[model samples]
Target: MVTRGTEILVIKRNDPAWPGLTFPGGHVEAHESFHDSVVRELKEETGLTIKKPKLVGVKQFYDDDDHRYLVFFYTAHDFSGKLKASNEGQLFWMTKDELQKQKLAYNFDRDLPVYFNDNLSEHILDGKRDELF
Candidate 1:
């Protein structure tokens, strides 16, 4: 997550695999750590450089296509650079209230509370194909 003040950077995806408003992230490439992948994915998707992205949660589920998906949910507070749009779709910053009004991608609604509630720890969320985007 790329954050400034109370707003967060999110991408409106174009990929059918996962389409809609969501945080910028992708598959962790071979030979790259999760931390490095987050930095790279953030740049590729939103043109931002972030550091020390702490692991917030892990979302594991299968999509409508029956493909298993394991997502590493991260939150970054320190970052730099101007935002840019990619093939992923558009990049936008929204406050919590604004975000609450938007149509989120699939089960992201289940992840929101953990992000807003400080007491929540790194969690493993499991679901089935019916819960996908």
Candidate 2:
């Protein structure tokens, strides 16, 4: 996940799952550290070249489609580039307060507040999605 100021960056996904409001990240490449993957995925999805982001947490999801994902969450204090939308979907800069006002994609309400409160690291690292609520 990438955040600008108090606002978090969320991608409106084009796929079947949720199809909107996802963190800016994806699968880690071979031989890549989780941190490096976060940077790479951010650039690929958001078109922003971020400085070294601090590791916050990891989220693993399991769905009926045999879907499994381990998402590495990070926070960046600085970055350099223009914002461009990726094939994933549109990008929105949502402040913590503004989040409740918009039509957020599913599950975002479960996840984003953790990121906003900076408690994402502990929950994710512990594989505690169920505890989020």
Candidate 3:
């Protein structure tokens, strides 16, 4: 999920998944709302508490190596708790333009820009239907 406040928070996964400069999120747990997953992921990965995470967009990524991922994006305006280094990676806030320049795990190159401009409704209704990456 994409947790956006004034700045974007990204993490480098310590595991095999794309491990550099990625949106802080993960799998949707059993019986959990997508929104709650966003909150839970943020808190677990970054130690932050968030309120009202807005759904942003959904997108998929497919790699030549046969790795694929589907992600639900979300944004939070209100948050508390201190930022500490977790197993995920270093957390940092950056402007949208700055994000474009980072070595973002592949899919972000195509999807995140769309999210920055589009409203939540457009994203929910039509975003995931296409392959942004």
lDDT digits (tens) for residues 1-133 of candidate 3: 3345556777766766665677777789999988888888888898888888887666655556657666776778788888766887787878776777888874556666556766432221233354332
Q: State model 1's lDDT.
A: 0.78
Off by over 4 Å in 3: 1-6, 61-70, 119-133
- lDDT of candidate 1 over 10-120, digit per residue (tens): 788898876778888888999999889999999888888898898876666665676767778789989888889888889999998888788888666677766776766
Give the Cα lDDT of each candidate: 0.78, 0.72, 0.69
Task: Supply the global lDDT for candidate 3.
Answer: 0.69
lDDT winner among the candidates? 1
lDDT of 2 at 62: 69
The local lDDT score (0 to 100) that residue 115 gets in candidate 3 is 64
Clashes per model (N, Cα, C within 3 A): 0, 1, 0
Shift in Å, residue 9, candidate 2? 2.2
**TM-score order of candidates, top first:** 1, 2, 3
Q: Per-candidate TM vs. native?
A: 0.84, 0.78, 0.75
Report RMSD for candidate 3: 4.6
Q: What's model 3's lDDT at 27?
A: 83
